[model samples]
Target: MVNSWWRRSARALAIALLLSFAAPALAADDAADEVGYQFSTDWTGPHTAVWLRHLARFMKKPDIHGLEIGCFEGRSSIWFMERIATHESSTMSCIDVFTDAIEARFDNNIEVAGFSDRMKKHKGYSQDVLRKLDYASFDFIYIDGCHLASCVLTDAVLAWDLLKPGGMIIFDDYVWALEKAKTQRPKVAIDAFMTVYANHIRVRERGYQVIIEKLAPRSDRELVGKPVVHSEEWEKDYEKKKKD
Candidate 1:
């Protein structure tokens, strides 16, 4: 079992390394360049030319739905609205505390970009807002809410249930260091989540941002004599078993 785990880890690492080199080329989108977006900060720019563009190629469908955990000034949110969520049926939802007059700027940016009609703004903590969202409804989920490991883990776990099968989840700032302790960083929580869901997801990119694509539902269910389960159901059952 240990050897098998090592093999899988090595394979995943190899793929990640290869993807890193090809990421820039794969992310090139001519249409995305056509948009005249407005943003005060450049935090999300470093990522846009790479994995974000690559993601747009695969997940940009007519009915694509996206959720963002931390939207500051609508920088990354605007990218999704203009790039991936281009279809009339496509929609984007953002969760943020909107402190420090950030929401006004976010709102203005979205409005200026002509994406106000397609966006849903949830002004609250991610932990609270994510709970109220629909499960398995989002084709893409971007987590950049809190920098702490505990908060990051909570966001990832909650977001997993909200993501549809084959959906993509992007965790930002995997290597960020606001706290001195390693346990306080987002990498620790992201690594833990990845380790737990290793069998259920495919790691697509590993850099400043970590991207994973959901392969199967985390809960279990059965249909037409076939045994199947979604991850959310499995989590509930696990909790119930623990209680019993």
Candidate 2:
């Protein structure tokens, strides 16, 4: 038994290392690149193309629906539309507090990609826009909005309730360090969400992006195994500690 476990762990590690090195090369062949979507910047394409391309094979369906919190220049949005949401019935909704120029560019890019009719643009803050969206209506969601910890946490929690069972969510810039304080970044919030919701979702990848698939409904709070202590026991302990 011990030998089998060790062998399995070693094989998993080897596969992870191989993919880490090979993904960048594979991304070059992604079909989205051939569309020539107009972009003011290329922040997400290189890091996300390999995974998104892989997902397209399994996730592309006629009735697919996608949501994105940030759609800067429609780079990732176009990729999702052209690659993953390829069917005529497929649709994508994007939420971003857009400036006039940015919105114009995004509009033009989506038009060029022939997704203007199928795309829904929400011009507002994600927290507000997310609340208004229909629950469990999305099969795929990409979260790359405000990088602040608070915003990321809010998005994750709300988005969880909206994700259909077996649906996937991708949180971008997990290792970003532009902010001086560690508490201000997305990783902290992503870690907290993953820890609390560990029983509800299966983590698919953990790199620049944190990808997860919903295994159960968010309303299902059942833990998978025995917890260290029940809530009643924890409450009693807390009261005792306060007296001590």
lDDT of all predictions: 0.80, 0.80
Q: What is the lDDT of residue 131 in candidate 1?
A: 92
lDDT string for model 1 (79-198, tens) is: 777677778788999999986678887886687567788999999999999999998899889999888899999999999889998899999999887456976789999999999888
lDDT of 2 by residue, 202-240 (tens): 998887888898898544443333445568989999999
Cα deviation at 108, candidate 1, in Å, is 0.7
Mark the regions of model 2 whose C-alpha exceeds 4 Å error after superposition.
1-37, 57-59, 218-244
Clashes of each: 9, 0
Q: Residue 117's C-alpha lDDT in candidate 2?
A: 90
